[model samples]
Target: MIRTATPADVPAVHALIRELAAYEKAPQEARATEEQLREALFGERPAVFAHVAVDDVSGETVGFALWFLNFSTWRGVHGIYLEDLYVSPGARGGGHGRALLTGLAWICVERGYERLEWSVLDWNEPAIGFYEALGARPQDGWTGYRLTDGALAALGGSGH
Candidate 1:
């Protein structure tokens, strides 16, 4: 079953995040704290939204997907930007990942969004194939970039 996540789901969500980080070989970079997650996901003003997939009989969380809205200048519509999608190793091959993606796609269509986008590491061939099988194509011409911490500070100071 897939449903919107609540504050009560934070612990399980964090556990899955850690599992995903470890699988991606960067466990140490999963620095999110309970307080931060709570504030961002359940506080008065939400920064993002999440959906959890639960086992029907066991009632255990098997996977989750977190996302936020983004505007596409070219399409002139707001679409979902998937931040993370993690499924426990034990739950692999169970269709949970496809279920999560389907749910998100339904949300996009229901809301009239023009697109949904996410990035997969180049080395994660399994994930790349899974996404391709779902009819998603890689944005061949675009490269993602980010500025963090000191870079952000410098940019802020530069006022440009």
Candidate 2:
């Protein structure tokens, strides 16, 4: 069954994040700490949300999906932007991934959001195909960019 993640699920979610990073070929890049996750999920002003898939019989966490609300300037509505989605390697092929996405889609429809979206690495053909099969079209000709940590600090200090 799928359910909203509470603060206590931070450890499991963090481990899933690491697994996702490893699947993306960058295990060392997962820098999220359990404390950080707790703060993010249970802070005075929470910045993100998560859902988990649990086994009915074993009561084991089988998957997790982390996302946040993003504003769409064109649509003028708040939409869910999925950041990380991972299903335990042994728990895959059991509809967990699609079930997680369906849950998020239900949230969007219930809230009148215009879209539900996420990014997949260019090399992950399997994932790209999976999303396509779900009727999600890729937005081509769009380039992604990021400025983090030191670069972000430097730019902020530049006082534009």
Candidate 3:
């Protein structure tokens, strides 16, 4: 069963994040703390949301989808930008990933949003196949870029 995550789920979600980072071969990059996640997901004016997939028999959280809203200037609607989607290795192939995505898609359709989007690593063939099987097409012409660490600070602190 998939349900909205609560404050109590922060630890599980944080662990899942580290697990995902390891799967992505960059455990060191999953630097977020539970406190940060708690604030982001349960703060007074929260900007992010999370949903978890629970095991029916064990009542354990097996997967999670963390997302946030993004405004599309062209579409003029707010769409969901999924930040992370992960299912525990032991719990995969049990439909948890699909359920999590379906839940997010339901939200978009219910709210009249034009898109539900997320990025997957180019080399993750398994994930790529899964997404393709779900009718998700890659935005081929676009290359995603990030400005972070020293560069982000330098630009942000610049007066220009």
Ten consecutive residues with minimal summed lDDT in candidate 2? Answer: 7-16
List clashing residue pairs in candidate 2. none
Deviation from truth (RMSD, Å), model 2: 1.1
C-alpha RMSD for every candidate: 1.1, 1.1, 0.7
Model 3 whole-model lDDT (C-alpha atoms): 0.97
Q: What's model 2's TM-score?
A: 0.95
- The runs of at least 3 residues in candidate 2 whose Cα sits more than 4 Å from the true structure, single-residue gaps closed, are none
Weakest ten-residue segment in model 3 by summed lDDT = 151-160
lDDT of each: 0.92, 0.90, 0.97
Q: Among all windows of ten consecutive residues in candidate 1, which has the lowest summed lDDT? A: 86-95
Q: Write the per-residue lDDT of candidate 1 for residues 24-75, one digit (tens) a residue.
A: 9999989998788878899998979999999888999999999999999999
- Among the numbered candidates, top TM-score falls to 3
- Write model 3 residue lDDT over 25-75, tens digit each, in one string: 999888999999999999989999999999999999999999999999999
Name the candidate that leads on lDDT: 3
